[model samples]
Target: MSATEIPEPQVWLDERGRPCPLPVIAMAKAAKSAHGSPVIAVLADDPGARYDIPAWCRMIGATYLGEISVPDDKGGSAYVVQISESAQTDASKSIG
Candidate 1:
């Protein structure tokens, strides 16, 4: 989704500077407390995140809505995921 189209009070994660897998881990962690199919925005400069987030969604059954633009100061692109409302009642409780 576009910047204006992003969900209100969305979970915005700053996973920049983290190593491989950390960004995905952080995204999954935030999703664990989520309700509805809220969109999550992860600001990550790690190149792996571009590939990892979508892979995580495929494995976790969430929707990978692709990346969106952020302000120059954000220092990273925002990758969004739509937590499937039916995926879990307590969000993603497992790491697998």
Candidate 2:
């Protein structure tokens, strides 16, 4: 598959319409869609994500690979975050 078609989960936050938690929620949905263990990337326009994404990663026990800033032609920025496998699953869960 092509790089764009790699099947990685991607969440797009509404840049002009939503607020802080919405971006975080979007990231969560993308992570959840990974079926408990896959690296998902989230694209958000909210400044909150710079901190929120990493914080969420911590709460979910996922690895926050970090964020990249992509500038749009129109003069805005898009933040892409790489969520690691550890962040996707509840590794703390124990076998019964």
Candidate 3:
């Protein structure tokens, strides 16, 4: 998929107002439980997440689809990640 293409997230994680690490931690957990979903979207306000989530994806071999702005009422933006079937397998193996 193109860098600008963001799939509809099969799993949505709302981590707005949560501190650093928490957003990424919740994202990892959500991703682990996604059951082969193509995309997982994490809603977070933490400035750190703008970097941390992508970094986590890199470390885990998942595709960081990039972030999209959320409505002000919902918070700042949502971080989108694409997990390939192979990446899911890799992640599961690593987690287990």
Candidate 4:
């Protein structure tokens, strides 16, 4: 999707300095808590995020809206995600 088409993040999860899978987990938690299809921005500096975030999004059926540069001394990157409505429903579904 085009950058202009992506909506601004409704929730920002700062996972900078955190390790690979942790950021992904944080994103999952954020998506689980949020309602509807909200845009979420995850700030992370770990190199793994470049691959992991998009992979996680795809695995969860969420839309990976691409990464944006974050202007800060830390020089962290902002990975954007569009949480699909089905994602929340799937998360709420109980395992049998």
> Using lDDT as the measure, which candidate wins?
4
**Per-residue lDDT over 1-96 for candidate 3, one digit per residue giving the tens place of the 0 to 100 score:** 453577767777888989889988887666667776568888988889999988988888888987766635765688899887666676677768
Task: For candidate 1, write residues 1-96 as lDDT tens digits.
Answer: 565665543778888888768888888778877776777888898888889899888887888887777645858778888888655543455643
Query: In terms of TM-score, how similar is model 1 to the real structure?
Result: 0.79
Q: Show the colliding residue pairs in model 2.
A: 62-87
Model 2 accuracy (lDDT, Cα): 0.56
Predicted structure 4: lDDT: 0.84
TM-score leader: 4
Each model's lDDT comes to 0.76, 0.56, 0.79, 0.84
- Please give, for residues 25-50, the per-residue lDDT of candidate 4 as tens digits: 88888888898899999999899999
**lDDT at 15, model 3:** 89
Candidate that beats the other on TM-score, 1 or 2, i.e. the better one: 1
Worst 10 residues of 3 by lDDT: 67-76
Worst 10 residues of 1 by lDDT: 87-96
lDDT for each residue of candidate 2 in 13-94, tens digit (9 for 90 to 100): 4443466887777767666556534555555556776788778777877766554444344423444445566655542331
Ranking by TM-score: 4, 3, 1, 2
TM-score of 3: 0.81
Query: Model 3 segments beyond 4 Å from truth?
Result: 1-4, 93-96
